[model samples]
Target: MKAGDPGDCAGYRIEFESSGPLLRVRVTGAGSYAATVDYWRQILAEVQARKPGGLLLVDELQGPALTAGEWQSLVDGTRQQGLETVRIAHVKPLGLQSVEHCEIYAREVGLEARVFDNETNARLWLRYGGA
Candidate 1:
């Protein structure tokens, strides 16, 4: 349950771990448009290569600071690739509004997405499908 190291960027960490079928991502730092896309591309590449069949956990991210275009691209990429369950966890209170917007966008793109302020709850839902 340790956090990963930050990327070359100033305020971003991308760590990957496995919890059963889920690929857990622990991201810490600012989530701007370019940096967030790069981070996710790297992680998604790994997931695509592995082709795991569980959930994708985006943990401790402080984002949706992305422009609308970036958000659309992210959602489109996920849908096009047909990634497994994707869940986002935002520990800080940075982008609640943006998270809501992203949730709606995700739904429109035919993905089931949710946001969580509590990391524990986020993990639980991702792990158990909110049973």
Candidate 2:
């Protein structure tokens, strides 16, 4: 099911799903740093509680609007929590700089992170265990 719009954060919606150890998150609409963090924290808590061995799939997200600090926080937090993988899917075009930054952060954190133009590919990569 989908998490209702936060209402306070430019109509952002957080959807959660679980398949065995995999946790899926879909964030839609404009969102502030605080809102994004809150959503991720909640999802992470659930993942920890479940103690899953699978990855995290984040879909339909707009990454360019996110500040570098916010991205770093997310990467660090997920890494610290020992989540096996994170795959983010962006519906819109992403700049080369943003892509490079994500790649670097993923490498630093030892998490397989990749940006995909399609949700299907992201899901496949996350499920099949690919960097």
Candidate 3:
């Protein structure tokens, strides 16, 4: 969890913490999913441009469930941007069902996304840059 104020993009307030080439994006909260994604698309574009091969750790906690289209958006966005990320650690959304569903979709589409219950494990994966 991030403290203090973060840079706001659309409805999503983000904290960008980096140790050299590794970047971690902590999304604290969002006003709306649609607006958040809209902003995320733009933010991701910038990230892709700025750091192509850097590991990205995205910590999304207690977030709303994502629709199929939303999942597709992530899939398409990563593919379109050709973001060859070293690794992406996504802290699981609240609730087991949501986490399971998200994991299933990720596995099916080869999203290269992993969901974790806490930041500790997620951070470990990001630190190691491997599964």
What lDDT score belongs to each candidate, Candidate 1 first? 0.61, 0.57, 0.56
Task: Give the TM-score comparing model 2 with the true structure, all chains together.
Answer: 0.66
Model 3, 1-131: lDDT tens digits are: 23223666655667766667666666755534565466456547556655733435454534567676666655555554534444556664444334445455655656555777776877677667575
lDDT of 3 at 74: 52
Worst 10-residue lDDT window, candidate 1: 1-10
lDDT at 57 for candidate 2?
A: 43
Q: Which stretches of candidate 1 lie over 4 Å from their true place?
A: 1-11, 59-64, 67-69, 84-97
My TM-score estimates for the predictions, one after another, are 0.71, 0.66, 0.67
After TM-score superposition, the amount by which residue 11's alpha carbon in candidate 2 deviates from its true location, in angstroms, is 4.1
- Candidate 1 per-residue lDDT, tens place, 1-131, comes to 22333355547777777666666666777677777677767666766755555545554556556566667877777766645444443333343545555666777877666766666776677666652
Measured by TM-score, the strongest candidate is: 1
Q: Is candidate 1 or candidate 3 better by lDDT?
A: 1
Question: Which portions of model 2 show Cα errors greater than 4 Å?
Answer: 1-11, 61-64, 84-100
